[model samples]
Target: MAEFWERYAEININDRQRKVLNKLLVADPDDFEGGISNKKHISMTNASSATATRDLKTPVETRMLVQSGGGRKARYGIDWVGITS
Candidate 1:
């Protein structure tokens, strides 16, 4: 399970996002935070925010697109919280 965190935390997440994951997912896997979504999501890297649309512009598309907005559309995958391929 430690390996899972290594992969997930590798993504550059904001302070708020970090708190969410650390509290909700990593620290207590069974603990559910108020209003925090346990849906499919990922932590984004600097590259994502730097993109034109904050989207990964590559021939090989990524699982989750960049979400620059707040709420659900504000998260992007960075293989940190990503499932190992």
Candidate 2:
């Protein structure tokens, strides 16, 4: 958690984005069987599909999250290497 905040300290993250990221940060591996997806983000934040996509994109752009696959198969996992805590 400290690492995450410190890493993104200079970036602007809104409430919904913060909530989703924080959840991902502390979540157990078992909690995300296939990692996080657009559907998962929507469910977690009650945000629209577009909103979820946009929110998820930021972390990926900042290298805080790593993406796998493409399109519907796409999933996101925390960039453990990037966090380095």
Candidate 3:
């Protein structure tokens, strides 16, 4: 976890983004079968859809998360390789 945060030391991850990232870090793989959806992010962060959408972008841009699908099916997963390396 310390190493993971170190990788993003140069990125500015806000409270909501931090919350979601922490959740993802400790979450069971089964809980996120296809990664985290916008709807799930909303539920976890108590953020509006627009806010969730915006918050999710930073990690993707920083290569912390990888996106998949589109629209209602869109999901995001921590880039294990990106961080591990």
Candidate 4:
């Protein structure tokens, strides 16, 4: 996981994005269905809801994170295979 994180550093992600990814990496796979939400991100990163939303987008777009649900109920989880492979 450390190696994977180190590899990601070359990309243009922000500190919040890195923090979110680290959280996802350690989270249980069973919890992924109802995974981390934007509100959680806001709390974790101490950023605004809008900032959390934007921070999440880059990982989703890059396929490092997988998004589910929609709107206020949206949740996110790490793409394990995408990261490990």
Candidate 5:
């Protein structure tokens, strides 16, 4: 939605965050997790594990991404309503 994009554009997301967000946006719901881990982000962005972790943090804080689990088991997904509202 244009509203969502506008709000997203106002955020201070970096390249990694943008990439991860795009992946999550287009991912099939069934394949969303694939497993609760940051490896998905690392593989998608070719980023280091630490970089992926940091990249994900801003989205979570801004409610663009919802995070669950803990540590290496953590997972992330798009917050559809959060963004579009």
Candidate 6:
């Protein structure tokens, strides 16, 4: 998620994206089923511009619901920051 916060944008994701992101947020990062394997993944592909990152300079909006710790760390709060609940 650090990579995303460094170069991400403010995106208002749709319904499907919300559901998928919700599932992936709390789930373990290493967990296979926890990733974006749900039906909502397609929506992410369709709306590439919404979440896709152009480069380090260009910001890309991601759907990260759960965030990390403090101390100069980056928190990816998808439902909270990326997309409003």
Per-model lDDT: 0.36, 0.85, 0.89, 0.82, 0.74, 0.38
TM-score of 1: 0.31
lDDT of 5 by residue, 1-85 (tens): 4566677787888877776776666667677754325888888888898898888888889888778888877887777775543
Model 3 bad stretches (over 4 Å): 82-85
Residue-by-residue lDDT tens digits, candidate 1, 1-85: 4554555454554454444334433444334322222142223222333442322332013322233345444333333335553
Residues 1-85 of candidate 4: C-alpha lDDT, one tens digit per residue? 8756765666789888888888778767775447889998998999998999999998888777789999999998876674563
Provide the lDDT at 18 for model 6: 45
State each candidate's clash count.
4, 0, 0, 0, 0, 1
Minimal lDDT window, size 10, model 5: 28-37
Off by over 4 Å in 4: 6-9, 28-33, 82-85
TM-score of 5: 0.81
**Model 6 global lDDT (CA atoms, 0 to 1):** 0.38
Better of 4 and 5 by lDDT: 4
**lDDT per residue (tens digit) for residues 32-76 in model 6:** 232332123444445443342221011113334443443223333
Which residue window of length 10 is worst by lDDT in model 4?
A: 76-85
Model 2 alpha-carbon drift over 4 Å, by segment:
82-84
How would the candidate models be sorted by lDDT, starting from the highest? 3, 2, 4, 5, 6, 1
Which is superior by lDDT, 2 or 3? Answer: 3
Each candidate structure's TM-score, on Cα atoms with residue i matched to residue i, is 0.31, 0.90, 0.92, 0.81, 0.81, 0.30
Error in Å for residue 42 of model 2:
0.5
Q: Write the per-residue lDDT of candidate 2 for residues 4-84, one digit (tens) a residue.
A: 788779888789888877888888879986789999999999999999999988888987778998898889988778566
Top candidate (lDDT): 3
